[model samples]
Target: MNFGDRVKEVHREILSTPHGDLPQEFVTEAVWRGEAAYFLGWAIQLFDKPHPSTFTDPGALTGVLQLLQPDANELVPSARLRAHPEIDDYSALCLLIRHLLQLQEMQAGGRDSLERAYQSRLAKLGLSPASNRLEPGAADAVISSTAKDSRGLYVVRSLAAEWLLGEEE
Candidate 1:
């Protein structure tokens, strides 16, 4: 299915059930859809930044979905997109996703372990916690992250990256 059709279906599924009523697996898929939507929205300047969490900020996502012509296969027009993806933003988001994937690997880990692992990784790179620079492409970082999560958001972001970068080339 094309991006527009796929996202519209996901959006419909998301709205079909109320939050608390949806099954956990269903909710998880919806969260992934939200993440994908957020990425595309940010890419098109629909928002200034990706939503901080997978679950919050539905309004922004809803606005993005509403902009699509249902079942159109095509992405938002080029005129709506930024001249290009900001390398810093792309790298930072990818780094965060990579960190989350690593933390997710640890057995029965929680938020605390995530923070510790993040700091340790930062130290290893000689980067302070406040550092904005990130080393990019830790080898199939997108596939690795999406594979671990079983959610489609990372894949969507990767597709967005390819779509945008493909245009550049």
Candidate 2:
């Protein structure tokens, strides 16, 4: 299936279970996949900005559920999309989010892995530290944002600043 179809299918399965009673595993998976959805949502113009609160606030998560519903009429046609650039941005953001999350978990070698990924992805997009597209201490911001609230949304938000904000300009 195409990515749109897959997103719709996953949205169905995720929303099938009511919010309050969702298993922890299900919720964890949702947060991870939801990061992708946030990218798709931007590509399709369903979202103009990433809502970081979706990770911790039930009400915000409910709003995302509403927007991402399979039959939601928010998606634009694929013909209108600049697919390659969006894909590059998505990949870069994915790497950034993964690096930040690993750092938050105090994982060893996160910076080294991130540097490698930056060379491969962010460098091409002019987002490497040399280009100044990626702000300094972005990982620290995510870590601080989630210190009290260990939800994955802060990582999403940090990467959003790197990507979605650029889309606006």
Candidate 3:
């Protein structure tokens, strides 16, 4: 069945239920959960089918990676790419689903690892972290020693996404 079909039915059921009349956090969570689940399920079923190998080429992936800036702030809280009980914008959801597909293929093909990608980036900037976690380098100080370059938010977003994705993998 379609996402609209499933969600509309939920809306109908919720409107009829006692919780439906009460606009509360639980209701919001319920609706978001349903939507997120629906989208993820749809994405899995749709992409799991056979497709051309052109989509999995390394050069194509590199191009895609080059253009993909962290978009953690683009989607609404519920509409993020996470598979949590929340809503996400259509664009954000689509990008996430597509990225998952690409990452899976890249792994299967034995291509460059995401860790390597991050490491190479830091190397270019002459910055390397000794640990897996990114220390803000503000230990024992009120101010962060590492200066912000306006993309600090993006780094936080990327790290969060990477953490979540790593858990899944």
Candidate 4:
């Protein structure tokens, strides 16, 4: 099946499940595939548009990205999305979405606000963002580190920022 069909099937399954009882494994799989499809769709849409001077509203983009961010472990592979490149691209897109969202939040209300928004967004996705944090000392270290460790996330974020700022040629 194509991406849209797969997403539809997964959405149907998720909707059919009883509230507060969705299987974690199923949710993870669904989220992985769904995020891939969502970003792929956005990529296509952005491609079709004529190059604009700048993104009309970065906040809107941040909101969409926040909503699309998946709440699953990156190591977990989705059965439906078996291609390595596809998975990598999807994960990178997710990371960029997160990075941009954090940036926007930080600009608005400093580090504390960013942390709160990040936790709140994850909670809305039914994921525990707190669990991902390291110990207080380690957390500070990680937070202070540059974003260069993940090549995929960095590359995606760079390209996205360029596009958002209308620097794309």
- RMSD over all Cα atoms, model 1: 9.9
For candidate 1, lDDT tens digit of each residue in 7-112? Answer: 4665566666655676676776776666666766776776765523233366666555554546333444442765432633563454466556555666664768
Let me know the TM-score candidate 2 reaches against the reference structure: 0.51
Candidate 2 lDDT, tens digit per residue, 35-63? Answer: 65565555555455454334434445447
Error of 1 at 98 (Å): 0.9
Instruction: Tell me the number of clashing residue pairs for each predicted model.
Output: 0, 0, 5, 0
lDDT of each: 0.53, 0.52, 0.33, 0.39
| Residue-level lDDT tens digits of model 3 in 1-169 | 1233344654545434553364664565444333333333323332221121111222322232221223422322333243322212222222233333345457554445754654564344223322223234322121122233321222222233333334211
Sorted by lDDT (best first), the order is 1, 2, 4, 3
Model 4, which residues run further than 4 Å from truth?
2-109, 129-169
Worst 10-residue lDDT window for candidate 2 reads 73-82
Candidate 3 vs candidate 4: the TM-score winner is 4
Candidate 2's clash total is 0
TM-score for each of the candidates: 0.47, 0.51, 0.21, 0.25
Q: Which regions of candidate 2 deviate over 4 angstroms?
A: 1-11, 51-74, 78-114, 124-126, 129-131, 148-169
User: How does residue 134 of candidate 2 score in lDDT?
Assistant: 43
